[model samples]
Target: MTNEQANCDTMVADPVVGDGCRRYVLPRQRPGDSTGDAPRVAELKCKVAELESQLRDLRRTNDTLKMHVAKALGLQLDSPIPGAGFETTRGGKAANAVAVSRRTAPGAVRGVETQVPKPTETPTGVEFRVLGPVEAAVAGRRIDLGAPKQRAVLALLVSQVGQPVSVDVLLEELWDGSPPPSAITSLHAYVANLRRALEPNRAPRKPASVLRTRGRAYLLDSRMVQVDVHRFGDRAMAGWQALDRGDPQRALREFDAGLALWRGQAYAEVADTTHVAPEVVRLEELRLWAIEGRCATLIAMGAHEIAVSELAAFTQAHPLREYGCELFSLALYRAGRQADALAMLRAHQKRMAEELGIDPSPALQHLEREILHQAPSLG
Candidate 1:
């Protein structure tokens, strides 16, 4: 068999990632070749399209079934209890009623299928966004979060949603460990105002739902609220997992979706407080990792020129970061700028040694060697 036929045969059988060692290029079709690979690839493409359509349909059907199940389970909650003046409405109260029945009248829902989502499940009610400013939106409508201190409190709880925050911790964060005689009272007042803003429709004298009290501590319930920080984390993790699985296309898609959630600096209203500072820095670092991963996946998918354009500003923004330098060098090498790639690495090495008094990392040094030889594995 000719070389073109061998290339065509390999391209048809191997995935685009191809064992993570080499690029998988489809050869041009030759005249009068009996291999018939042109039509074979088209046939495989058609099959893939058909399978993808079927998968989408399956997902839609599954979603429809889940909705039907939710409706069926909620039907019992919608009915008024005997001699009890519960409103026959469909909302938080209905969901609460299910919990009540399970606890008080266990036998009633003993055999019933429960669909009450756990606290970790993302809710459709209130979404707290700390990726940008501390903001809350209830069903697409943004609410007024009272004062700066109150927003800082929310930001602290949002950074650690579903966990209890002690009153002492709250006071320290709010007042910087210098509490006035009226400090506790003022904190109570702030929490009251926050509850009013967040759960405006919460009935009077009923325990505060969204932001709840636990002895001397308070917690923002994840079950009742959705957070963009959590969403970004999930998407970023998924993207990394996809990249590890040699699916750069899916990785890029996930990274794009995740990074789009960031509007500005994390916890912008309360950037460097005692409680919020660590989380703010950690989130920013995660954002950087996701961005770097995105560029790596782009280069892995043979879009090295696009990666080069992206990493140019990233390297400028974070020149001392060895991983970013390594990625930029690899992207340059893959984009066919072999000389430029070596120069970029050497420049980074100089900056490291001059400014930080340290040599480049072993990985970066190895990458410089790889680019010098135009290693086939750079692809």
Candidate 2:
């Protein structure tokens, strides 16, 4: 065979061929060689082509699923996923997008003067506060959310705002898998009471606008209500992105706005409850991360004293957190308290050895060495 033909045959066997298409080259036929293998080679090539097609289809499906999972987990992707704007029902069908109504301007009256509206009136719609003890306000009025169990139900719905939650899942969460005989009936009553409380003006038998009913499930329309948790997440993500882009001032503002939404321990009222506990923990961690981001921004802005004071209380609250220790020590060192910085790391080392039977992390140990030698980079 010619050199070019030999090279082609070698390239065909390689798996890393570009454009995701496999090139199959049949071996060159010799004189008096049997032609019987030609059909078999062609068949093998067909099978390879079929397999490649299937692989491409699978990759496409995987990418689509990844986008969906990211969206479900509250991540913003650079490219929008198909059908993301629509909510999916329990029956695996996409529901129609909720329509947002636009207000029309009033007609002009030629002979009458128009009075400006007062700013004291609170805007309509439900406002949810889940950063602390769960609270809901509708049209500026506090809602009587009923007993603990009922509130727990609302909390679950609020956590997954705009997503349909199955009745079975709600039952499992509410009763911890040991529901009573009347659990379904009780749940219905609670939902009815919540509907009445949230929509006092809805006529009997009319469809709900805020809390919607899907097949075997319920969904809280996010557009009809405002959730502080979602707002905080958006701001926190923005802060993180700003910090990554080297805009510490904007990062600080975003982090402060997000952190200020927290009134106290997140979901403190329902934290003891089984189902909401995970969500509470997740939100609390996010809150701490925001605080850390804010402190990092302050340090970047040369406000090391503020970071030292803030991180002092933060490290005390979370002594075992290595990032907290690193930031705190760095802040002290930058604030001209080198001795305090070294002392903090020594204390951390001792505490870790005594409490957890482990040595300090590599980052902490490196910081300790840096402080000992008065590293110029510590500045």
Candidate 3:
């Protein structure tokens, strides 16, 4: 057939024939068209189905092997053995029985089903909000974490994040240096309760145990959960290093997010109650550093007006900090309020001299001279 006839046939024909008229004709396709990978695609899909079947078999075998190993070692496995489905009875007679379901498909692997039965429920990812009351994510929902005491325990663990919290240390913090006779049992109960609350469905069959007791201490598996305070500190430390490395843009991004994590005081209600005073001090210091880092980044970015308000608040909170005072003064001076900046420096210097019996640091003095446009001695 001619090219025009072929084109007319393609446009109007319901089912076109190939050039030889022996095979059905198909539509044109590009090199990267999804249909272009038909053979490889089919092969991959078959391979995936095969691998999935193999995986299901391996999981069943592993489950059995785990049980055997647990029995041999006198250790308990974290999951239940595969078994029959649950059956409910009425009037001493089993009726409307629900058969245990398993997913089966063609080419299924031997000694393994295509899909093993899953529990009716499973543990959802745990949510931790140190920005506010420590809350948990259970079953894809948020639940009230616990009472003040429990929250304090959670906070202690969260504050340390990945580090192990010792039993003695926890007892001391929980009881204010004097623990009860059954504190150990109480701690165990608390951990169990937390696990159950965090994973209600899995609690009975297989518990979600993030708190592990080893030797004399308990470790909270921070990797499996999110903690806002830990995230803040980690980002702030990285931001500080970024600043040292002369990457102010990235540093600003990090410090901004880190400082924003502070909804209120670090550990707010539990700070004083838990012997987390040292941690409180550390976070407070980091908070200041984060704020300073932000101001420095802003100044480096040439955002004088934006840094003014933050610097003002920071200087008020930390009048003795020479760097903060200097930054505030420079921000004000750069914003064309030289007179106000000079007054601020003098007021802070006077306060420092009176309160700490020391004058402002040389850095502050040098900044003041620079602000006043005065020439300092070269030698």
Q: Scored by CA lDDT, what does every candidate get?
A: 0.66, 0.66, 0.58
| Model 1 CA lDDT for position 176 | 81
Quickly count the clashes in candidate 3: 0
RMSD of each: 18.2, 19.2, 27.1
Ranking by lDDT: 1, 2, 3
lDDT of 2: 0.66
Q: Which candidate model has the greater lDDT, 2 or 3? A: 2
TM-scores, each model vs. reference = 0.67, 0.63, 0.59
lDDT of 1 at 77: 37
Which regions in candidate 3 have their CA more than 4 angstroms from the true location? 1-124, 138-140, 180-185, 201-208, 241-250, 374-379
For residues 1-379, write the lDDT of model 1, one tens digit per residue: 7775454444332112222111223444456755656766665566566545644544454345435533432322332111100011111222321100000011022132223223454444788888888899887799898878888888888876788899999898888889888989988998899888888788899888889998999998778888887678667767766765556678789989999999999999778777777777767766887888787667666677898999999999999967678778877876789999999999999999899999875446646765676544454
Clashing pairs in 1: none
Residue range with the least summed lDDT across 10 consecutive positions in model 2: 100-109
Error of 2 at 368 (Å): 2.5
Runs with alpha carbons beyond 4 Å of true place in candidate 2: 1-124, 176-178
Better structure of 2 and 3 per TM-score: 2
Leading candidate by TM-score: 1
